[model samples]
Target chain A: MDFKLKIWRQKNRDDRGRFVDYEVKNVSPDASFLEMLDILNVDLVKRGEEPVAFDHDCREGICGSCGLVVNGRSHGPGRGIATCELRMRGFKGGETIVAEPWRAKSFPILKDLIVDRTALDRIIAAGGYISSKTGAVPEANSIQVPKPAAEEAMDAASCIGCGACVAACPNSSAMLFVAAKVSHLALLPQGKVERKERVLKMIEQMDKEGFGNCSNNYACEAECPKKISVTHIARLNREFILAEIS
Target chain B: MNKFTALYRSSVGKKIIMSLSGLFLCTFLVVHVVINLFLFKQDGGETYNRYSEFMSSNPFIRTIEIVLFAGLIAHVISGTLVWLKNRASRPVAYEMYQLKDNTTFTSRTPMLTASASLVGFFLVIHLRTFWVPNRFWETAPQSNYDLVAAAFSDPVYSLFYIVALVFLAFHLRHGFQSGFQTLGLSDKQYKWLIDSVAVIFWLFIPLMFAAMPAYFLWFK
Candidate 1:
């Protein structure tokens, strides 16, 4: 198959970005989107042009580094799948694919589709963990976490920190990301001691990092590769309210 | 108050404000439309003109009018702030992509259509007839009815009013359910019911108002 790509390119954070169109031909339908980009980069190298810069560690999609707004959706048109897992078969032959960086103030464009997603790391660092001593490991059965709570916390914990939520959010809010982190620890008994401080600090950090407020549009959930429910946002709100009282 | 500030600081605060203000406005529409229906008087011995006169003289109702303007100002100002803040939250992605149909069209386009309705008719025709003349309330209610008829006589005025009502129908449809959601009333079990009711209210109220002018101008 063949595709025409209008890919966003920029030299640095301050540089004005624009789309540079390129055509890739004879691509395999089974290849991942990143693999297709690799093929295109190979062509660019052969012609003595600068290779397109993008981030991808685990091409299997778990790393969450490979995100793009393909044809105007995070991680392309696939559901519950990351960009690395998205394949060429999703598009028809000779289709013109538009690829751009996520448009969020918090995720500034670094260079050529690469964005600074350090804001997410800052939120996680705020209080996304269980605050405990690093001594001997406690027995697993010591804390009696309800089966449902544990399961739900595990589900919330599944967020891969891909920044897709921010990308898809109309307000560029990181509420989904913050909510996921807050819910993950807040739902478990082990983290309950610090749950109040956890949510408060996380939200403060999110806002300080320049993330926008949630618009309740649910666009973030729709585009999230993990399909993180907005219900977590409700959980986050509840936690925040309780924290304020405390 | 600090707690309130926290709530206001978050997205839910803005949403709550939008929803509450929207619901308030929705109630205003119902009552306003119902009152306007009185203008459909058949010119009997006692009619809408009397109702209008009663409303004009009531001091209690005048106080309510002040509250109504306050609500309008809060609703519009807060709504615009939230909308603009939401807009700036994320930069627009590539514009060529199609939007999903999941959210109501009216919810997405409230400001657009609402502005059109306000600008096209409400600012000029409505103020002129209802607001400009101090007599809107001063004259015994019959003059208000006469003014309504006078305004509806021009096809342009009538057409713009009808167009504005159509937009209000669109606004109210999403505004109703969305308002409930921000008030924390959105639950899975009653979501569909809420949606259906909203659609009905939106359509029925606006149609009732539009029917008044269309009927009065064309028939009576």
Candidate 2:
């Protein structure tokens, strides 16, 4: 399949970026979006022209490395998958695909489709962990976690910190991402020890990073590659309230 | 004092204030709507004026008026501050974006907040026409329902009301569910229940209020 791609291009972090259009002929319909970009880069290299730059690691949806806003929808119009998982067949042949980096005050664009997502890492570093030292792996049953709570924790844990929630949010809010991290740890027995402080500290870090507040737009939930529920956000709010009051 | 300052200073803390004040104001809207319903009685202005009189005179109601104004001020200030911070979060706008693909009308439209600002303007006008004069400034500002009937007699006056009520409806549509979500009261399990209740606030309340103006203009 042939496709026209309008990709954001910047020489470096200092260069003002602009959309540069490129056409790839005779591309495989089943190639993943990143793989299609690989094909385009190969062509650009052969022609001695600069190639588009984007972040990708595993080429799978799980690494949270691949981030792109394809045709205005984060993660390329597909529900519950990242840009790397998007297939060329989803678009009609000869269609134009617009790809851009995540735009937020915290996640500054490095070049092309790459954004600095270290702000998310800082939020995790703030208090997104169980502080107790565990020298050995404890017995799973000894923790006494209920099945429902365990499942919910795992659900929240599925968030990959891809920055799509912030990208999709009209306000550029990282609330959903922070909510996922907060809920993931808050629901477990091991995490309950620092629940109050964890929420307070992580939220303070999130605010300090300058992400916007959630307006209940639910775009973050919708564009989430993991399809993390916004209910976790409500839990985050509840935890923050409990933490603040105490 | 440190904790108190932190509560209002943080983003999440400000939102907590916004939700509480917003929900409190929603309750006031309900009471106001119910009192307006008395206007539908065939006894003319008698029943409406009676409730209005009690609302203006009762010591409890009078005392709560201070709290009501406080809540309004908190809601407006926190909301505006939050909005300014949110705008700053996105310094560079997306060159090409379609939020409509992912979000619902009320959810996506920044217009919802704009509508709320218009509703705020209408609130000032409403108080000037009714509340302040009837209660404080005037020696005799025509009896409540009679004054309302007289105001609605003007086509432009009633039309302005209908327009403002439209904005109020749009504001409440997003406000009710958004408040619940912010307060951590709406979860996946009970989101439908909250949304269902929101229909009464967003739908029933504004429609009932709009009906008053329409009744005075067309039916009465």
Candidate 3:
């Protein structure tokens, strides 16, 4: 298969970016989207041209390091899979695929397809952690978490912190990401010590980061690579309200 | 900032105000629809006129009107601010923006503010026609029913009413559950019920309101 790619190219964060057209020929249908990009970069290098720059760590979707809005979708055509998981088979032969970096005020474009996502890390740093002193590895069963609560917490814990939610959101809201972090800890017994303070500080950080507010669009959940639920956002709302009242 | 100021300044705080004001307006819609139903009584607007007279003349109802006005102002102002801020958050636009899965027309559009603005325009004409005349202008039409009936008799006015109600319905459809969501009432347990009620409220109330003009213009 072959694809005509219109990829956003930026020399650096300070450079004004523009879309550059490139062609990848003899691409394997089984190749992941990132692998196809790698083939294109190899071609560009052989031609003595600057290769397109994109971020990737684990080709597997878990690291949340790889992201590009392929043909106007966050992690490409399919939900619940990162860009590294998307296959070339998803597109037709000789199709023109447009790839761009995540567009958000908080997430600035650093290069061709990589945007700085440290704003998310800052939000997590604000309060996405439990602060228990680590003396030894404690027995997991001592806290006695209920089955349902544990399951719910684990579900919320699945967010990979990719900014797809922000990119896909019409408002560029990071509510889903923040909500996942807030709910994962709020639902667990181990995280209850600073639950009130956790939600408050995290939300304050989220606001300060210049992310938009959730307008109940549900695009975040729809486009989430991890398929995180918007219900977590509702739970976050509940937690914030409870924190305020308390 | 103090907690109160912080709450008022935050996005969530503005949303809470919108929710509360929207819920109040939703309640007012129910009452408005109920009273408007008196139009279909077939008493040549006698029953409807009497109800309107009592509602307009009652001191308690008048005070509630003030509250209703305040709620409208708050909902509109806060919603506008949130919309502007949300727009500003994304300084850049996607070249090929596509709606992802589960996104509805109502969800993507500025249905609340846009429809509210349309409804607000209709409200101005409605007030000039019915409210202003009925309240302050002593020499205006004696019966509220006659005024409404005459207005609906004009095809353009009736069509405008019907169209305005449709926009109001779209606004309410999104607004109802959104209000509850902002208030933290959209829990796993009650979300189904709240969504069901919202569907019914948006559909049923607007249909009922639209039926009044339909009845006066065509059915009668």
Best by lDDT: 2
Each candidate's fnat, listed in order, reads 0.29, 0.78, 0.55
Pairs of colliding residues, candidate 1:
A171-B89
Top TM-score hit? 2
**DockQ-better candidate, 2 vs 3:** 2
TM-score of each: 0.85, 0.98, 0.97
Which segments of candidate 2 are over 4 A away from where they belong?
none
Q: lDDT tens string, model 1, A129-227?
A: 886874798888887889988888888888999998887665678888888888888888778889988888888788777677754657777878888
Worst 10 residues of 2 chain A by lDDT: A134-143
Cα RMSD (angstroms) for every candidate in the order listed? 3.5, 1.1, 1.4
Model 1: how far residue A168 lies from native, Å: 2.4
DockQ of 2: 0.81
CA lDDT, candidate 2, residue B97: 88
Cα miss at B77, model 1 (Å)? 1.7
- Across all candidates, the chain A TM-score values are 0.97, 0.98, 0.98
Whole-model lDDT per candidate: 0.76, 0.90, 0.88
